[model samples]
Target: ELERMNQEINRIGVNINQITHNNNSALYSREDKHRLYVFLKQIKTLVSQVQERL
Candidate 1:
């Protein structure tokens, strides 16, 4: 389960990185910004859970 979570975190991070890189060239639409916000929240929640377990 921990391994799976780790993989998920990595995947999310990669997606966020790509989105940010894309945004560097163009302005983010409202939907794009919302998606990024959601992604950040998910990462925060996952990290918090991981820390608790550790």
Candidate 2:
């Protein structure tokens, strides 16, 4: 579980980074930006919980 969570955390981090870069680049539609933002936040919360489990 910890290993899976760790991999997910890394994946989330990559997604967050890509979205952030795209956001900075001013390329995403407003809705996509909002969705990615929400996803990133959820990923963060999940990572936190996973860390506690660890």
Candidate 3:
């Protein structure tokens, strides 16, 4: 179970890295910012779920 959580976290990290890279290569817009915020919220929820399980 711990290993699964670790894998999930790593996947989120990769997604974040990709998003950051894209943001770096482009200009920030309201939509992109909002999308990033939503994505981060999802990550936060997943983390909370993992914590609860542990």
Candidate 4:
């Protein structure tokens, strides 16, 4: 169970990283800038979830 949790944490971390990377891209205010904000928020949420679960 611990190992499974570890793997899940790692996977969520990777996903959060990817979202951060995408969110870190150059600005685009004219387009869907909200997407970046949403992604970053999701990253924060996921990180919190991982921390709580761990």
Candidate 5:
């Protein structure tokens, strides 16, 4: 489970980097921004859970 979570966190980090790259090329639409926000929230929650487990 910990490994899975770590992988997920890494994946999410990559996704965020992609989003930032896209934004630099051209600003993201409201929907895209919202999606990014959701992803960030999920990452935060996952990290909190992992911390609690530790």
Candidate 6:
């Protein structure tokens, strides 16, 4: 009985680790996307300014 309980505990620990890893990856991806969006916006603004000057 004790062995079975230990096995279950180990399995739960592994599942938690996997979930944490997936969450971190998702957060990193979201941050990267946000940064890219901001960079594109800046480029668009610069282009508009240059167009106005011309």
Clash counts for the predictions, in order: 0, 0, 0, 0, 0, 0
Estimate the Cα RMSD of every predicted model relative to the unseen true structure.
2.0, 1.5, 2.0, 3.8, 1.9, 22.3
Compute the lDDT for candidate 2. Answer: 0.79
The CA lDDT at 37 in model 6 is 58
- lDDT string for model 6 (1-54, tens) is 656655755675575567557666775477766775575577567556755755
Span of 10 residues, lowest total lDDT, candidate 6: 1-10
* Poorly placed runs, candidate 2 (over 4 Å): none
Count backbone clashes in candidate 6: 0
Residue-wise lDDT of candidate 1 within 1-54, one digit each (tens)?
Answer: 878888887887788788889888678988988887887888798789888997
State TM-scores per candidate. 0.67, 0.75, 0.70, 0.49, 0.66, 0.47
- Look at candidate 6 and give me any clashing residue pairs: none
Q: What Cα-based lDDT does every candidate model obtain?
A: 0.83, 0.79, 0.87, 0.69, 0.83, 0.62
Cα miss at 30, model 3 (Å)? Answer: 2.4
Candidate 1 similarity to native, TM-score: 0.67
Between candidates 2 and 6, which one is better according to lDDT? Answer: 2
- In order of lDDT, best first, we have 3, 1, 5, 2, 4, 6
Question: Worst ten-residue run, lDDT, model 5?
Answer: 23-32
> Model 2 residue 38 lDDT?
84
* Candidate 5 lDDT for residue 30: 82
For candidate 4, the TM-score is 0.49
Q: Candidate 5 versus the native: TM-score?
A: 0.66
The TM-score that candidate 3 achieves is 0.70
Q: Please identify model 5 stretches exceeding 4 Å from their true place.
A: none
Q: Best candidate, TM-score-wise?
A: 2
